[model samples]
Target: MIVRGVRGATTVKANQEKEILDATEGLMRTICEENEIDPENVAQVILTVTEDLTATFPAKALRRLAGWTHVPVMCAQEIPVPNGLEKCIRVMITLNTTKAQSEIHHVYLNEAVKLRPDLQLTKDS
Candidate 1:
């Protein structure tokens, strides 16, 4: 199997610990579901949050999921760009899979939909 990267991002409603964890979990779960990814197949997960969000580490959310305890996860602060999105959390999931790069779907939710309008998906779609 080849290694593939699945990207996703979402904006939280606020800089609260619960909001960060919930948003992170929601984004990660959607990415995994859309890509048919198994936690065991995930090699690593890198999570980043905007500088304005410092309430908690988003990686903590993943560890609470079943089968994700052993997965390697890291969290970092995104660069405080002058005009970048705020209260946004981004994720990159590296996993072993047979799917091609073109088959991987990147998810952007909430206000993060503006980040990559070309790849946007909707419940209706």
Candidate 2:
């Protein structure tokens, strides 16, 4: 088996706990779904939100939503660039997979796509 990193990001409507948790859950679910990941094969998940968002730990939301009680999940602040995506939440997950790196799918939803124009080849939601 090989290890690969999957990246996914999305924006929050506000810093409220409910909003943050909802956005985080949505992104995490999408990543798992798009990549066909099995929870047992997931090594760990590192989630970061823009410095402006701090209502709650994004990783906690991931754990709760995915029932990942035993997975190693961490939360941190993303580098605060002056003009960075506002209220953005991002995650990089290391997973055990038989697939190659080039086969992994990375998702950037909503306006977060602006962060990666080269991957904007798809119009599907």
Candidate 3:
């Protein structure tokens, strides 16, 4: 199997802990569902949040998901760029898969759709 990266991002209305955790969970689930990823196949998950979101570590959301407890997850601060999007949570999952890189669907939900307008996928997509 080859290693592929699934990318996803979502925006939170506020920096509250619940909002951050919920947004992170939603983004992670969509990425996994879109890519048909199994937790065992996931090598690592990296979650990053914009400077404005600090109420909690987004990685905590993953641990709450069934079968994700064993998955290695990390959380970090996103680069504080000038005029950058705020209250944003981004995730990149590295997983072993038989599919080609092009087959991997990158999810961009909520206000994060602006980050990758080409994706054209939202909460329902």
In every candidate, how many clashes are there? 0, 0, 0
lDDT of each: 0.88, 0.82, 0.87
lDDT assessment of candidate 1: 0.88
Model 2, CA-based lDDT: 0.82
Q: Lowest summed lDDT over 10 consecutive residues: which window, candidate 1?
A: 116-125
Task: Show model 2 residue runs off by greater than 4 Å.
Answer: 120-125
lDDT of 1 by residue, 1-125 (tens): 99989998999878999988988888878888999999989999999999999889999999878899999999988989999998999999999999998899999988888888887463211
Listed in order, each prediction's TM-score against the native is: 0.94, 0.91, 0.94
User: Comparing candidate 1 with candidate 3, which one achieves the higher lDDT?
Assistant: 1
Clashing pairs in 1: none
Kindly list the per-residue Cα lDDT of model 2 for residues 67-118, writing each as its tens digit: 5888899888999999899999888999899988777888887767777778
